[model samples]
Target: MVAEVFPLADIGLPLGARVPDFTLPDARGRLVRLAERLRTGPVVLIFCRSEGCSCCAVRLRAYLRALPELAEFGAALITISPRPPVPTLSTEDEHRRSLDVLGDVEQRVFADFGLRRELSGEPVPATFVLDRQGVVRARHVGVDHGTTMEPADALAAVEAITLG
Candidate 1:
């Protein structure tokens, strides 16, 4: 008998589930609340390992490149990591400046989202498309080091929420 393997995305916070509201500090030290942002429009919420992770950096840049389209759809992009934000190289700094990188220093928000890795307790990279009502419209939890939802898919998800 063969046991079917399910993707990690399927395990936590099933589809249509209303995400819990929480507050975390952004790069500039401003507290950002989930409910508050929801009042404006849908959000592309990303969970990443840490500010220093190379894979997470790549994922961040991908989303950064998609910012204009996301703005067109009236969806905000926010990234939360287990560690605090740090200064980066000049080239990367410019791109990073455009993103609202929140620090989940205590990993409380990660825990609330059920996004921690089983062995290391580090955050597993994930992307969640949330509607204005704070319900999760789409979610993609990465299976390993460099896996994550593509910007195109996330944009599509946001487009659905905006159009529907």
Candidate 2:
């Protein structure tokens, strides 16, 4: 049997594909379902390695800073990590409350989303903009370990989806 090869660009979920529904627990242990969030408006899904990773922390913080702008577009940010959620200090409570930090300890959601790195088996730092209908409008999957999608680009994707 011949092996079927997929192009490098097809490594992760393609644009226009409908994302599978998933339910993951947030930092506060509250269950957040993807389908439920879609009911409100567009959703920005971010997949990161771990909270301890400096790169991941930077990506998360950037998104946190863009939360207000994202809210203006009626888009919600949801971050998924392979490890269990660890509560942060009280100082970040307000920022943390704006987005949902989900824990996918089993990595099931990462696999389902096709964001797993082939070699490390870790979730690739990815940003997906899903419209209210659950269809992927834009996606950026990191090819390098420390690389992640920029907050402005993600917001632009959401803006386009919201506007168009």
Candidate 3:
């Protein structure tokens, strides 16, 4: 069982707290900066276990299916993992097959976000929705096998932020 901790480090990113800006490479070694992406629209950042996590895989597939639609609102969905870089070909293919499949293996960014929660020998699953200004608008930390934020709910949150 996952122990409940008071003042969970990964819960409730405050409405006005600025998300620390970061530059992490995508699957193809392309650099992506939080500041740069925010210039266009809201960024939905998903920090998950690199690979081998079944829950992460399921979350990625769900994001992959929802990507095109999410793009309509100019919201960029990004998924990062601590998995080491795969071969160039495999990396590209994986990006095409799953969620953005772009992330850092060094865990620098992951550590910065405080998403690393060691539970039962596995890292906890976490999600953060950051507005264009870099403030975290929504946050979810899950310890369950099926923990994830639904695409529709995320989209609605973005829409509300944009319209407001």
Candidate 4:
């Protein structure tokens, strides 16, 4: 007998490319469209599994720690996952905890971004920094415990974009 594994999609968006539009409801069930969200400022899109994933948690902690500073750089952080809402915990709660972990329970955004993969029965991990115009400026995929995006790095990217 042979075992079969699902193929993984290339995680990160290519540099200097525009992010495709996607609309998913936040935990509050309000529609959040990427194009609409970016009208204010740049956006950091964090893609992960559930809140229980260790690496996910670590990455979010980094984002949480740097939220205030990242805001100074003029970026709106948001996250997505495929996990549906639960009884005790809601997607809104996830967003509140991290200010970036929006719920993508429908998997629409995952499919649109080519990040839909089953890496251990969980969604593939990825991140993207999109400018206000929705072009992906930087991207990282498949995180390790210590591997995550830094606010300083994002600030640098924003400076480069705005200056150029």
Q: Pick the candidate with the highest lDDT.
A: 2
Cα error of candidate 3 at position 28, Å: 1.4
Task: Quantify all predictions' global Cα lDDT against the true fold.
Answer: 0.80, 0.82, 0.68, 0.67
TM-scores of the candidates are: 0.86, 0.87, 0.78, 0.76
lDDT of 2 by residue, 40-136 (tens): 8899998888889898888888888898899888788888889988766233534534478889999988888887766667667688899999999
Worst 10 residues of 4 by lDDT: 85-94
- Candidate closer to the true structure by TM-score (higher is better), 2 or 4: 2
Model 4 per-residue lDDT tens digits across residues 52-129: 777777776677666666566566777777774333334453454324445777777776776665444346677788
Clashing pairs for model 3 are none
lDDT of 3 by residue, 34-100 (tens): 7877887887888777666788877767776777666676777777778754433334434543234
Which ranges in model 4 have alpha carbons more than 4 Å from their true place?
1-9, 85-100, 118-122, 143-146
lDDT for model 2 comes to: 0.82
Full-model lDDT, candidate 4? 0.67
